[model samples]
Target: MLIDLHVHSDNSPCSCMSVAEILAEARSMGLDGVCVTDHDSLAVLAQIEEGFQPDGLLLLVGMEYSTPQGDYLVYGDVRSLPSGMDAYGLFSAIKERDCAVVAAHPFRAWRPSDIACVTCENVAAIEVRNGRNSLRDDRLAEKHAAINGLPRVAGSDAHCIHELGCFPTRFTVPVTSSSDLVRALKNGQCEPGEAFPLAVGL
Candidate 1:
């Protein structure tokens, strides 16, 4: 299954696209699924059913949680995961619940946190390729993941329709629920992939 695991809908303060528009665009782009990871909120989940799939295109809800350390792409139940905690604390919480966490755009130049600050044991993967990231940022993230022997994932980190599926992760097994997605990520059952026919190289 091909899934774009880092997308933002209008629920995110920074995104301009509505959930309907995001779903339409994902279908048009031939995506198998999209994780709506609105920043600091899971309000998108209220607007859709759990494991929502329209025409077999899944719409899974996650969150792009911001911390003083950096942003994290978090999967699984987030309602009880309180805000204002540092990244390390949040990662510990996620692990205790058997959920999953991925360091998001860790090497991005403008980000405040250092990748080295994120402990490897707590992370399920490193986002090696983000749609909005520069080549240098992605390369550095890739090298970090390689050095750490961590699983790598990718996503469009889309805030608008055009950006969806610019990068996606391919799962080796079928993923029907949020739990399944989390399991796939934690077990290294997925791999990063590029969008079809990119005008420029990834």
Candidate 2:
């Protein structure tokens, strides 16, 4: 299944796309699913869970946690994450939960310590192809993932409508829920993939 693992809706202060617009774009682009990872928020996810299901496209709720080290794409049980916790704290907190964490855009102004965290087993994957990242940054992230033997995932890192399907994570099996996605990531059954043809110029 093709899923964009990182995306922001209007719930994110930096994103201009509404939840409805994101769903429409994802469906039109032929994506099987999308992870709505708004920065440090889950209000939109709660809204969706309440009764906003879109036919044919699975919506997974996640959060882009801003730690002192860097951002992490956290899937499953975000309720335990405390505000401003560092990467180490995050690793320890989710170690016992059925969750997966991916280092988001690792080369985006990353420090040496931050790069080291990508190798941690606790971090299930790395964002090798971020739609908003430069080619150099993406290459560096890809190399880091290879060197660390971590699974690679891609995401639009989208903050607007046009960026919706620019990059996606290809899953070997169908994942209908957050827990399923986390398990797939943890088991290394996914990888980064190209952007949709329609999204090439964006």
Candidate 3:
């Protein structure tokens, strides 16, 4: 299945797309699934479960957690994580829940220390391609993932309509829920897929 493993909705302060709009766009783009990983929040999950259910497009709940070192795309429960937690503490808490962790845009300009965090044992995958990242940034992330022997995934890191489904992680098996995605990552059954060209200024 083709799934965009990182996305954002109106629930995130930085995003302009609503959850309904995101799902509609994903379906139109022929995506099988998308993970709604709003920045530092999973409040949109409830909104998804309550009102949005489109056939042929799976909506998985997740979050982009901020740590002092960088950001992580986290799946499964995040109730144990506290704001401003450091990388090691964040990894330990997520590991306790057996959640899936993908280093989010590790080579993005704002977080130079992300390479160190991505090398940690608890990070299951690294985002080798992010739609909004520069080519050099994506290549650096890819190189780090290769050196660390970690599985690679991709995401749009989308916060708007045009960015959804532009980058996705393709799974060997169908994954319909957050748990299924976790299992896929744990078993190394996923890989980075195609990404749209980066915008002019992004």
Candidate 4:
């Protein structure tokens, strides 16, 4: 299953696209699944009903958790995790729940360096490609992941319609729910690839 592992809907303060807009774009781009990872919150869940599936495209919820080091794409029981925790605290908490955590756009422009944080035992993967990241940023993340022997994933980190699927993670197994995605991520059963060229100035 090809899934955009990180996306922002209207629930995120920086995003402009609504849930419907995101879903339409994902389907049109031929994505098998989309994870709505709103920044620091899962408010987008309100817009998703039980078993929300349209045209066989799976809709899963995650959170782009903010920390002093950088953002992390967190899957599974995000509501149980609190804010203001540092990378170690966040990872430790999520580890106990058997969830997944990926460092999001670690080398993106002005974000703090994530090398140290991503090295933690609890961090499942690192986002090597992001829609909003420059090629240089992606390169840095790629090198870091390679050097650390960490699993790599990708995400749109998309805040708008056009950004969806620019970079997405392809899983070897079916990922029909949040738990399935988390399992895939933790087991290194996925790879990141691009579906379309990113628009200029992303």
1-202: candidate 3 lDDT, tens digit per residue? 8888888999999899998798667877868888888888868857767212556788778878887887888886654566677778888887778588888887788743378677648788888888878899989988888888989898888888888888888999978666778889977899987654533345
Q: Give the alpha carbon lDDT tens digit for every residue of 1-202 in model 1.
A: 8999989999988889898888667776878888989889888877777565657788888888888888888887776788888888887789677478988998886552358664568788889888888889889888888889889999898887777788989899999888899999888999897565651564
Better of 2 and 3 by lDDT: 2
lDDT of 2: 0.83
Q: State, as a TM-score between 0 and 1, how close model 3 is to the true structure.
A: 0.90
Give the least accurate 10-residue stretch of model 4, judged by summed lDDT. 193-202
For all predicted structures, in order, the TM-scores are 0.93, 0.93, 0.90, 0.92
- Model 4: CA > 4 A from native: 50-52, 197-202
C-alpha RMSD of each candidate structure in angstroms: 1.7, 2.1, 2.5, 1.8
Pitting candidate 1 against candidate 4, the one with the higher TM-score is: 1
User: Taking the tens digit of each residue's C-alpha lDDT, what string does model 4 give over 1-202?
Assistant: 7888888888998889899887666777878888888888878777785244757788888888878877788997787888889888888899678578988888887553377788747588888988877889889989998898888898887888888878889899888777888888888889886556654466
Cα lDDT tens digits, model 2, 1-202, are 8998999999999999998887777877878888899888988955676212547888878899888787888998876677788888989888878788998888887432278788757699888888877889989988888878889999998898888888988999878787889889999999877677756655
| Clashing residue pair totals per candidate (backbone < 3 A) | 0, 0, 0, 0
Sort by lDDT, best first.
2, 1, 4, 3
Pairs of colliding residues, candidate 1: none
In terms of lDDT, model 1 sits at 0.82
